[model samples]
Target: MKIFRKLRLQELLYNKKDKRLATAIKLMVGRKPLNLSLFKLAVKHSSAAEETKHGIKVSNERLEYLGDAVLGTIVAEHLFIKFPYRDEGFLTETRSRIVNRESLNQVGKKIGLEKIVESDLTEKGFFTHKSIYGDTLEALVGAVYLDRGYYFCRKFVLSRIISPHFDLDNIINTTINFKSKIIEWSQKENREVDFLLKSITGSQRFKEFTVELKIDQEFFTEGKGPTKKKAEQEAAKNACEKLKLAI
Candidate 1:
């Protein structure tokens, strides 16, 4: 039975499709994949979902869901160990910043994950759709977990994703509360700082807020975001950049 199974597996891998997927995954993960099917599903987008032999649809979404939880846990554990003296709020904020959509998208793109994503991005162009890369990044994590278990998956995330891509010092010291930072800077400089909501536009689901910052009665900068708080932060960040302030 063992001999037969080994031969069957060899035959399966000899097929062109399996070989291609196996090669791609090995390049991405820096190791050979045990189960090419799982990796295939990991790179598959929901738009390219197909029915299985049992009439069940399979896509990367389920793997993405699992990867999300796994990634969060690993990140939390990393932060906990890395910053033993930090508070819960600090850890949570750091984790959020690391795993935010934009960060994930940048990581995914940097790692060439978008090359393997099966999506019909003719209209908007693949580069324009950041979510695809981000989702694929999560799904790839799920695939690693399933094929190699949590230990190897955690190691891969740390060595390949976190260590290589992220600057730990920069992420830790990043000023998330830019509004507060600007306020403190203003107080130190004895300058009055104010954030004025200039305009609110778009529908409820797609609303945009524009905020303008005034420092000592002079218009410093303007920014826009999806929410008022975010707009204010963006404006503050712009102000910080304009003034060459170290955040």
Candidate 2:
């Protein structure tokens, strides 16, 4: 009797929590969630991850990885169909502009992820990372894929996320080659520019590269990414911002 009563109480508590989360999802995604636990896990940040008996931490990271692939595929297909005459390079660049960290972060905020995400970081610290919301957005995509299937997930991404937020023409027209801009500025100003590889970390499958940007042999900014070129691009973007060059 005691065990039965305890289990009943736990179920009731879970149901209550699920109810609240379901309401939030309906408002955000325009549909009621069928599997509430997936959505719950989607909002959980790595900083607030729970460890199990096997000493493995559980968070949104795995889902984020899955969602990243799915989102990329969906975006690639959409761009391909939308621009039949465009070359592969244009499709890739346009897709990057749509799915990049900064763009996703802004979209996440616009969709009210700030109120829904679960994190241990303070308000200011939470906002400082910039990637946290974007990561959560990807996790949410994974959850949607699992709960509603691929076709539904694609529709949600296109109708709810992409169509509402992005202006395709504007994104296509915008060129953001910060590395080229910085190099040109350096030449015109007669300043030496360099990108130095600082370090490489992480496992073989998931290596992260850190690069430092220097102008006239002085440290301007540092950036980290999955590849040296990406890290250098990030560093260059930061340096361009500092120099107030038109991006």
Candidate 3:
């Protein structure tokens, strides 16, 4: 605890939002972080380090690679020892789902790492930037592994991410398209939604559509997507998110 208090850089990197995470890491690691640069790089987006040459300035990507390998090996070993009856095929798929980019991004967002990230990107970077959040999350895991070890990394992941949020029973029945679910909920409540498609512009796979949802043309929620239907879905989703406003 004293060592962690000594690391002013840790305090700087993680602000009030990461309180639980900080406490969890401190308790699980049993030792404060000594290497602050590794943690800094973990939360740093590649765009922020574009001036430095690739494979030289040390973006989190390289650390992500190492972390991915380490996580895979550790998970495989754990599953192997824990579930002696489980087959290799099942283990592989399970590990894949657990370590997928989308899953990591969800955890990263829930933990508020997005706010603490050091990135030079703009609003356009959200969807346009490929795997920034995912990469940053992986780098963070890598940093934890380096700063502490397998035990702490495993403990922190299980506690902060798996136990607190990743409920196996609930997740199985959960709706993946939350935006669409929001719209359906709104419709059931007798709320009318109107989605207006403004534009569709971009090359093939990179195309984007701008849309806005009008609740009686007063309550509006804007969204963008690759197609008109998708854009409308996003707008409806946004509208659903705003239903608590009591308008």
Candidate 4:
């Protein structure tokens, strides 16, 4: 059993296609019995290899498929219990926003998934891309579910992966249309506003995009985040609240 497991790990680690992903597995599942193949399969983008020699292609799409279902079910249960009064539409939209690629990417980057998981080879850059990282995160969940029983997997996901960073209330309510509110307030005040992506720090996945909001050449506020849109929204929200233009 031990030899078989080690061989499987060897195959996953030594394979040219999957070699670049060694660091990612260690970063996320350190000291845990978490099967490394699950993560490798998770990070394998369809673009990496269309097919293997035996006429089988490795891709995270299937894992992603399973992950999508798992994520929806978990989030649904959380919502159902958390907000007994929330209608189906509200719960669905809220879950959608939380599990969407952009949001998942933000979560992954916030947790530093990119730092430990990356391709040393310049051959592919999906590790640092949110579109892929987010998808892979989902696939990883699927893999964990398969390796471990549902209860243990669910517990790990809830306690470690999903719960710490996920603030359902803040996500649902606080991220209101800050930009739109700023625009309306600016119009009311007869002032023009601008949001510029000034500079960017960090990689594409864990990036900190800097944004500057100016009103009629006067700098209103500055903000930074993983996405330009998010930073700009922060700047806008700050400007609005500070100026008492809009709530």
Candidate 5:
């Protein structure tokens, strides 16, 4: 009787928690979640991860990985269909603009993810880790994919997330190829520009690369990103901004 009573109490508490989470998810996603646990896990950051008896930590990292792939594929497909005459490079760059860490972070906050996310980071620490919200957005995408499958997930991404948040026209019209611009400026001025990898941190799945941009053997700026190319691009972007070359 005691064991049964304890199990009943746990179930009741779980149900209460699930009810709150379900309402939040519905307001955010415009649908009721069939599996509430997935959504719960989606909002859980690695900093607040729980360790199991088997010495395994559970968090949203795996879901973030899965969602990154899915989100990339969906965006690629959308751009491909939308820009039939555009070249491969255009499609790739446009997709990058849409799905980059900064863009996703903004979108996540706009969608009120800050209220739902479970994190142990303080307010200052939270702002310091700029990609946390973006990572959580990706994990939420993974949860949506698992809960509702590809077609529904695609619709949610397009109709709910991308369509509502992003301005495609502005994104396409903007000149964000700062790396190319900086290199062209260097060539025109007969100056040597170089990007050197400074350091890499974090685990394999979540590595952050730091790149330093140097011009004429002088340090220009530094940038960090999830990939070497992005880090280099960021460094170049900062350099261009400092030089007043970015249009």
Candidate 6:
């Protein structure tokens, strides 16, 4: 019985290191990865980066950088073709709406990317920064580009990632001025709308802002963002939801 148990343990260990794991990851993105090492590096956060013999640190940061450019280009091309009648400003604004960090995080979550990310935040549970998922998704895109080239990466991104999750038509038609919407709703309902900049944390390069929305002198909802404007907008968005105002 002891020998049987030992064999089972060894099987588990071998399975953990199996290439099938890499193949499974590829299946998630709807494509097989030619170089699994790139995908492995893509999911590795800076906190888990290892030093190589060449005196260089390897992490997903560079991949994320490359993926950001690739994603921007793909998204720009998509927007250009989809909205040929629209002006440059409209195209740019719409593209920003689509490729924003929060949107990408949502997409990443939908694709189960969060389940595979190797990060310090994994042990922290829900307290981790939201940007990690988005960053990892971008890194995966970079890996796909390196492994499969531009055309394949673009197709995978559009078909598996963007097309399934985003409705570009709805996105184009939707207005996102949550603050103004909240204010207008408040005026109609005779409720006082107030936004308070509660606190600012972190250094200049990476500051986080907290904002709270109060309705009729009562706390409605609070939100946090990298900038005061964004924090207020988030707070207002929450307020809008709480009040059941369709945005």
Clashes of each: 0, 0, 0, 0, 0, 0
Model 4, position 125, has a per-residue lDDT of 58
Question: What TM-score, over all chains together, does every model reach?
Answer: 0.68, 0.71, 0.55, 0.57, 0.71, 0.65
Clashes of 3: 0
lDDT of each: 0.85, 0.86, 0.66, 0.71, 0.88, 0.82
Instruction: Give candidates' CA RMSD values in order.
Output: 10.0, 9.2, 11.7, 13.1, 10.4, 11.6
| Candidate maximizing lDDT | 5
Candidate 4 lDDT over residue span 1-247, tens digit each? 6686655555544665455455545456442434666776766666664576899877888998998788778777877788899899788868876777766766666666565343333535543443666776787778777766577667766776668878777777865787899889878879999998899988756889999999998887998877888898889867765764423
Q: What is candidate 1's lDDT per residue for 184-234, written digit by digit as tens?
A: 999999999999999999998999999999988889999999999999999
Residue 43 miss distance in model 4 (angstroms):
2.2
Off by over 4 Å in 2: 1-14, 177-213, 216-247
In candidate 2, what residue range of length 10 has the lowest lDDT sum? Answer: 4-13
How far is 63's C-alpha from truth in model 4 (Å)?
0.8
lDDT of 6: 0.82
Per-residue accuracy of model 5 over 1-247 as CA lDDT, tens digit each: 4574445443355567687888889898777776677999999998899999999999999999999999999999999999999999899879988997878988999898998899898888776666888999999999999988999999999998899999999999887788999999999999999999999999989999999999988998999999999999989988876775624
Candidate 3 residue lDDT tens string, 125-198: 76566456667767777888887787888876666655675665454344346356666765777766666777
Error of 4 at 195 (Å): 23
Backbone clash pairs for candidate 4 read: none
Cand. 3 TM to true fold: 0.55
Q: What is candidate 2's lDDT per residue for 1-247, written digit by digit as tens? A: 4474445443355566677787888887777666677898999998888999999998999999999999999999999999999999899989988997877877898898888888888878765655888899999999999978899999999998899999999999877777898999999999999999999999999999999999889998998999999999899988876764643
